[model samples]
Target: MKALRKIAAQAGVALEEVPEPSAPQGTDVIVEVEAAGICGSDLHVDDWTPGYEFMVPLLPLTLGHEFAGRIVAVGPDVEHVKVGDRVTVMPSAPCNACPACRAGDSEKCQNKQTLGLRRDGGFAPRVTARASGCLPLPDAVDYELAALTEPLGVGATAVRVGGVGQGDRVVVLGPGTIGQALAIFARLSGATDVAVVGFDDAPRLETCRALGFDQVYDLKEPGAMDRLKSDFGGCDVVFEATGKAVSITDGLALLRMEGVFVMAGIHEEDARFPATDFVRRRLQIRASHGARGPEWRRVLAAMAKEPEIFRKMITHRLPLDEAVRGFGLAHERGASKVMILPGQG
Candidate 1:
């Protein structure tokens, strides 16, 4: 099998001929990957960013977690999902004995094993994962869109954490894949006013606008903030999806008193914010991590309800052999969601 791997502690990924994965004992399933999505976390690992030291020990690992595939084999204990099922796996698997997992908060389990980060992932034709993590895809969702379920699940979790509801005003900072997903989920949660802000006039910003976002603002433009304030009054929930520290401060500034701030991006460094302002405003800060089982169900249902919009977010697709080029496109500013067809080429 050909797989894309992070072969060194450097700023690139290499495609190499590797042994095809097989299902081992203990409820594992071997999936023949159809499509995989290049995510922002993959970009961080490709660039060897500061917070990615965790990848050092897992060097030479296959680098994809957002993928959907057909099951070719399963261990003896795997009965719920069978061979030939089309599915997408949750990106992380929790140690069932952990305190968090025991209490049904497996997303916070300290002993969780992440797919692309800790083990071999779906950047190849075949990958092995625990059967417990796989979710069967509905007939309405195809492989390409099924590959997006994990990220959309993350967005749903963020919206749930932020307590977004009918008639609430919402603001999302950054128009990347996660940012777009955040906006979609917020609107689905019945937010009456939704605005997305970005520093660059990237293709993603336009993508958000095309997705019918009420307000899409380029921060570099004059009077952007004034327009935002004028349109939405003040934000009841602010989702900081840009990972940059400046976005945190900007989101705080946009948030109304006692508003909820959801940190939905993965930051590579310590982010600074005004403690006094946070206290004075009585703001609530919630950090959203990866999605769990319940959130995955919600995201899949959303995909079923609105498949066209989800399909529109997929702007680029490449063969697995062109993964290096695909990574380049994903890292570029304008690319929306890049998909790698593993079975092709």
Candidate 2:
């Protein structure tokens, strides 16, 4: 099979011929990947960003976690799903015996192996995953959209953690894939004013505007923050999705007193924020990582209800062989959601 493999610890990936994966013993399932997404994290991995050193030990990894496919084979112990089922796998597989997993907080499991990062991922035509991680896709969701469930789950989890509810005002910094997902899910969670901020030239911002966001602000514009405050008073919840140090400070400034601030982006470097301001405002800070717990089901249900709107986030699709080009588009902010059709040449 042809897979996009990271043959080195550098800034690129190569499409190489490799052995097709099979369902090994112990509840594993082999999936024929239909579509996979190029995520921001993948860009960081390709760039060998600081703090991503853990990936160095897992070098030559197949880089893809946001993917959906059809099951072609399943191990003997697999019961929840069967061959021929269309599904999306949760990339993080928690060790059931860990204290966090035992406490039902698998997201914080002490031992978790993430697919596509710690193991072979869907950047290939076929990949093996633990059957327990696979979630059945509804008929309303197709392969391309199901591939997005993982990132959308991140957004859903952030909203849940931030306690966003009916009539709440929300601001999402960064209009990338995860940022756009946050805005959409915030609206579905009953937020009346959901605004997204990004650079004026970012292509993803155009998608945010087309999706009918209540407000889309370019941070570069004069008095953008003042205009945002004038229109919405202050945000009830501010989600920092840019992963940049500057965005962290700006997001905190936009929050209303006692508002919740959700850090949903992965920052490779250290970031600083005002501790005095946090205390003065009595603001709550919550960090949202990979999707886990009930977010998978919630996001899937939300996507099922608004498939077309969710689908609009997909702006580019490429063959598996064009994986490098796809990553370039994503890294350059030229594409909102770039899908790699692994089965295609």
Highest-scoring model, TM-score: 1
Tell me each candidate's TM-score: 0.95, 0.95
Off by over 4 Å in 1: 96-107
In terms of lDDT, the poorest run of 10 residues in model 2 is 225-234
Candidate 2 has a TM-score of 0.95
Which residue pairs overlap in candidate 1's backbone? none
Q: What lDDT does candidate 2 reach at residue 221?
A: 84
Question: Model 2, which residues run further than 4 Å from truth?
Answer: 96-106
230-278 per-residue lDDT for model 2 (tens digits): 7755579999998888888888888889988899888867889899998
Clashing pairs in 2: none
lDDT of 1 by residue, 35-153 (tens): 99999999999998887787787788998999999999999888899999999988688878899999998667887778888899999999999998899998999999999998888
Candidate no. 1 TM-score: 0.95
Per the 3 Å backbone cut-off, how many clashing residue pairs does candidate 1 have?
0
